[model samples]
Target chain A: MTTRTVTCEPQNFRRVLSSMCTEPHPLARQAASRFLATNPGDPTTYRTVSKLESEVVERLGEVTGQSDVEGYIASGGTEANIQAVRAARDFHDVNDPNVVVPEHAHFSFHKAADVLDVELRTVPLTERLVADVDAVAAATDRDTVLVAGVAGSTEYGRVDPIPKLADLAAAVDAFTHVDAAWGGFYLPFTEYDWNFADAAVDTLTIDPHKLGQAAVPAGGFLTQSRKIMDTLAVETPYLESTSQATLTGTRSGAGVASAVAVLRELWPDGYREQFETSMSDAEWLADALSNRGFDVVEPTLPLVAASVSERLFERLRKRGWRLSRTANGELRIVCMPHVTRELLESFVETIDELR
Target chain B: MTTRTVTCEPQNFRRVLSSMCTEPHPLARQAASRFLATNPGDPTTYRTVSKLESEVVERLGEVTGQSDVEGYIASGGTEANIQAVRAARDFHDVNDPNVVVPEHAHFSFHKAADVLDVELRTVPLTERLVADVDAVAAATDRDTVLVAGVAGSTEYGRVDPIPKLADLAAAVDAFTHVDAAWGGFYLPFTEYDWNFADAAVDTLTIDPHKLGQAAVPAGGFLTQSRKIMDTLAVETPYLESTSQATLTGTRSGAGVASAVAVLRELWPDGYREQFETSMSDAEWLADALSNRGFDVVEPTLPLVAASVSERLFERLRKRGWRLSRTANGELRIVCMPHVTRELLESFVETIDELR
Candidate 1:
C-alpha cells in the first residue's frame, strides 16, 4: 500500500507576510484582533473593509476630480482587468467586442479578452517604449468597445500615452480603460503629470496591495460612469445586494478591512511621503546602475528598468540578487514602500563589485 | 462652502467574523485575530485564509471519499460552478463547448455557460422532480464536454439520480460535475446512499459556509483528477506558484486557513452529527407543515421545499421569517447547523396556526 504523505507547511506567500509585518504596530494588531472577534456577514463584517474601500475611493476621486467615482474591490489586478473588460463589453452591447491594448500591456488584458471572447488588437510601442498613438488609432474600428492604456507597462515600467489613447478612443466614442494596477496607487502622489481621472479614461485599475501597502487580493477598478457599473450589476434574490457592485458574489470582508486599515494609517502626508521616497530611491538606483555601465531604461515615473549584458546577468544571479528580466533583455526593479534605501544601495554596490 | 460627508461605516460582513469566534475557543480566535492584523498581500496573511479553504476542502473530501481532492476557494457557489465548467471545457478540448444541465439546475449554470460561450442544453426533470436519466442521455452530442447533475436542486431540494447520470456520462465520454453546493456539506451524513466518490462524478461543488457553519465567500469545487485542476492552472512569471494548483491568482490565504480550521475543529463524525441534527429538524418541520394542511414538498436531503400559497408567503414575510419561494410556488427552508430544532418547531407551529 502506497501511503500518501501530506506534510503541512505554510504556503510561501504567507511566509512573506510574516516577514513583512514582523513587528506590527500596536494599533494595527489591535485593529486586526477586534475584527477576528466579530465575524459578521457582508456590509457588516469588519469596520475596516468598508471604511477602507470608501477612503480609497474618495482619495482617488479627489485626485481625479471625479465626484461620481465608484470602486469595487477585487482579488488582484487580473480580476480587476477582467471586471473592467466585462463591464465595457456589456455596456457597448457589441456582438464581437474589441479592445485596443498596447503590445506591452499587462497579460491580464489578453487573459480577460480570451476568457470573455473579446477581440484584442495590439498596438505597437515607439522607440521610447511608450504606446504608439498612431498604431492604436489605426487599430480602432466600429466593433471596438474599449481602448486600454497602460499607466505602467510591466516590461519597462513606462507609462503609456494615455492622453493620446484617450483622445483616439473618444473620437470613436469607445470607452478608455487605464491599466493602472501598478501605477494608480503611486501616480496620485507623484510629481509626474499623469492624471488618471483627467486623462479621458473612464475606467482605471489599481492594486492597493502593490503600491498602497495593502495585502494581496486587494485590487480595484475605479469608474466615473455609473452606467458602466450598472451594466455589470448582477441582482439575485439569494444574494445580499448593496449599492456597491462587484463581479464576484461573495467577497472577503477581511480583505476590505485590511485596505481600510492601510488607508487610515497612511493618510494624505503618509501617502505623499511614501511616493516621494519611492521616486528618490528609483532615481538613485537608476543612476547607480548606469554608472556601473549597465543600460538602464529610465522610467517616466518611479520604476527603473535596466538591461544587463548576458554575461553580467548570469553573474548577478549567481551573486543572489533576484530581479525580473523581460524578453527584451531588460531587468525590472520596483521601488516599493517596504524596499529601503540601504537595500537598494547594497544591491547596486554588489552589482558594481561584480562588474 | 459645501461640506461633503464621508460616512466610514465598515461593512457588516467583516464585523461578522469577530462575532462568530468571539469566545470559548482561543486557538480559533487567535487564528482569526492573526488574520485581522495584516492586509491581504502580506505573505504571512495566508494563515487565516488557507485555514478556511483547507478546512472546507478537507471536510468535503472526507464526505466524498476522495482525500486527494484539489479544491480552489472561490467567492460563492456561482464562481465555483463557473470555474468547474471552465476547467471541464479546457480539459476535454471541446470546440464549441456545451454543458448538459437539468432544467431545474441553478441559474449559475446558465450564467457560467453564457460567459464561457458554452451552449447549455437543459434536460427535463422526471415526475419525481429529479433529473431524467433518459433526457440527459439524449442531450449529449459530440460537442458535449460536461454534464452537471444537481444535488439538492434549489427549487425542489431533491438529489438527482447520480448513479444513472454517471453511467450516461461514461457512455458519452464526458466529464460528470455535481453541483452539490447546497447539499455536499450535509448529504453525506443524511440517510441517503449518495457517496460523491462512489458516484464517479469528476467534480463536486461544496459550500462550507452554507452547511459547515462557516462564513460566506467560502465555497469550493473539489476534484480527484489532477488533469482537471491543471486545466485551470494559470501561470505567470509575476504570480506566485506552488505544487498546488488554483484558478485565480492571489487567493485569500486567510479564508483558506479559516476553512482548514473549521474542518479540524469538526471532523467527519462531528459534521455528520451536525447534519443529522439539521436533517431531523428539517423532517420535523416538513411533517409539521404537512400536518397543518400546507402543501409542503417532502423533506429532500438537507432542505425542506414547501409550497405555501401566495397568501401564506406574504403572511410569513410579515411575521419576520425569511424563507425563499421558488418559481413553482414552493418555499425553501434550509435547515442549517446553526438553526436550532426549537426554533424550527416554533416556526412550524406558527405556520400550522396560520394554515
Candidate 2:
C-alpha cells in the first residue's frame, strides 16, 4: 500500500463493446498471475509451461477439427498471421512472392506484407461482405504464395467461403491460411466450412484471448502438418531447443497457462452457450437499431455494423461508451461474451436518449 | 473452489543462473494482474496503461542517458531488437540492405535478419570479447542499414565499444543500435559509454523484465530521434490512433503496467544496490571456479563463464541446477538480481562435493 499508485486504471469490461477481447474467465486470470514470471521461449528451463503450450496447440487443433497438429502459442493473432505469411513466403521460393487475401482480412496481413517485402493483393468482397471467390481467383498468379480467408471479418464478422479459397490456393500450389482470430471459438458450433476438417488449410490463426475467454495475448496458431510449420524455424544457437520458430523471444507463459485454463474449463460446451448468448444479443441490437430507422448489416456473427449519424456517434462516445467505427463509417459493436442482452438494452436506451 | 490444476510450476529464481530475467518485484506482480485484461494496442480504450507506456519509454530514455526519446514497450528483448533492425532497414530504403553486428550479439539479430530479409554480417569479436572496432568498421558498407553493438552480451557479459560502433555506423550513414537488454539497468550505475548520451546511438534495446524486476515480457525499445521511430509505423484502419508502430497488435497492458511499477520502485538507488550485490556475487563465482582449477572469463558484469568438464556439466544438470552452456562449450553463471552470494557459495560447495 505504501508503494506508488498505478495511474493506469483498468477499463471496465461492461463499458467495452468495441474490442474483440472479453473479460478473462476467473480461472484464466488466476492462472496468468501464477505464471507471470515464466518464459516459454526457453522450453528446457520452463518445462511445465512449454508442455502446457503443447497442450494448448493440441486443443486448438481439436476444436478446429484437426488432431495432432503442430504450432506454438503466439503472442496474439497478429504474430501468428505474420508467421503464416512468413512460412509461405519462405516455403515457395518465388521471385517477388505475392499474397492474396480478402479485403476483410485483418490489418496484420498488411503488416506482414510490408515487413516481409511481399506484394499483397486485396481482393474485393461479395455483396454479403464475404471473400468473393471470382475476385480471389482472378488475383492469384504464379507468384502468389499465400491466400488468406477471414472466418470472422473484423468490421462485419462475415465468414468467407474458406473451402473455395483453399481450393484456389491448391490450384496454384500455394498455402491456405485462415484468420479465424475472433471466430475460432464461435465457428465450432456453427455449420461453417472454415476450419481444417472442412477446408485444406495449411495454417490458421485463432486467438484464445479474443473469444476463448482467456486473458490478453493468448493467440493460437496451428499447422495441419509439422512440415508446414517447419518452414518458419530459425536454428537456435542457445537453449536446449534445437530451433526457434516464435516471432518473439522470452515469451511469457501467462498466455499459454491462461489459454489452457479456459480451454479446460469451457471448450465446446461452455463456448457454445456463450456463442448463443452473444448471437442473440447481437441480433437484438441490430433489430433495435433498424427499428430506429438506421441501416444495419445482418448479424452473420456476433458483430453488428450500424449506420448511425456522426453527431449521434460522437455523443454516444461522449457518454463514456467504449465503441468503434468500421471502415465504411458504421458503428461496430462486437457482442463478446461480456456484452450481454441486458447491456445492449441499456445501450439502446442511451442511444435513444441522445437521439 | 476447485478447478483443473496448473501443471506449470513457476521456476525458482535461486537456481536459475542462466537467464537474464529474474523474479518480478512483488509490486510489479500485483500491477501485472491488475492490467492483465487491458489491451494497450487500442490506446483510446486502455488510456491509463497507454499513458503508463509513455512513462516507461521516458524512463527508459532517462536510464539510457537520453531524455525525450521515442519508442514503445516491446514484448521482450527479441521484439525490441527486431524492431530496431526493422526501423533501420525500412528507413534506409537501400536495395539489398545489410546489418553489421558483433559476433556475440544476441541471436535475435539473426532472427531479425531472416524475418526482415536483410543480409547479416557478423564481425568477429576481440580477445576481450567486446566488439572489435576495426572488424565492425570493415564489415560496414554503403548497403549496411544497421550497426549493432552489445552493451551486455549474453555469453561473457561483455560491453562492446559502442561509441566506436556508432562512429562506424555514422561513417557508413547507417543507424546504430545498442543492445542493453541485460546491462541497461546496471550500466547506469557503472562508467560505460554505451547509451544515448555516450554515443550517436539511434536505437537501444533494454528490458525491464531482465534486471528491472518487472514480470516476464516487459522489454523496452527507445529511439534517439522521432524520425527513427516513425520509420516503423503502419497506418491503422480502426481505433482512435492514427497509426500502429508496434510489431504486434492487440498488445497486453500487463507488461506496460509492471514495467512502470518496477521502474518507479527501483529506478536508481534500488538498482544500484542490486548491481553491487550481483557484481560481487559474480566476482565471487569467478574466483570460486578458478580456485577449483577451472578456467574462467573475467566478470565484466554480473556474468561468469567457466570451462567445466562435460561430465561435470551433465552431472550438475542431473543434480537439478538450472545452468546453461555458451557457444564455446563453457558453463555460464549469470548473477541476476536473485542469484545471491550465499546461493553461489552453496553452488561451490556442491561442485566440490560432486568432484
Score residue A109 of candidate 2 by CA lDDT: 93
lDDT of 2 by residue, B113-182 (tens): 9899999999998898999999888899999999999998999889998888998999989999999998
**Residue B316 miss distance in model 2 (angstroms):** 0.6
Candidate 2 C-alpha lDDT tens digits along A175-278:
99999999999999888999999989999999999999898778888898787667778877657677888999989888889999999989889999999988
* CA RMSD, predictions in order: 5.9, 1.2
User: Across residues A1-355, which tens digit of lDDT does each residue of candidate 1 receive?
Assistant: 1111112333332213112122232333344343432222234333445555676676656645576688777766777787778777877866688999988887777667656778989889999888898999899988898998887766666788788888898888788888877777667765444455567878888766566665444666788877877866643432222333564555554455555566666656777887788788989988888887778888666677787877876676566554455657666676766556887887777777877
lDDT of each: 0.64, 0.89
RMSD of 1: 5.9
Q: Pairing residues by index, what is the TM-score of model 2?
A: 0.99
Residue A64 alpha-carbon offset, candidate 1, angstroms: 4.2
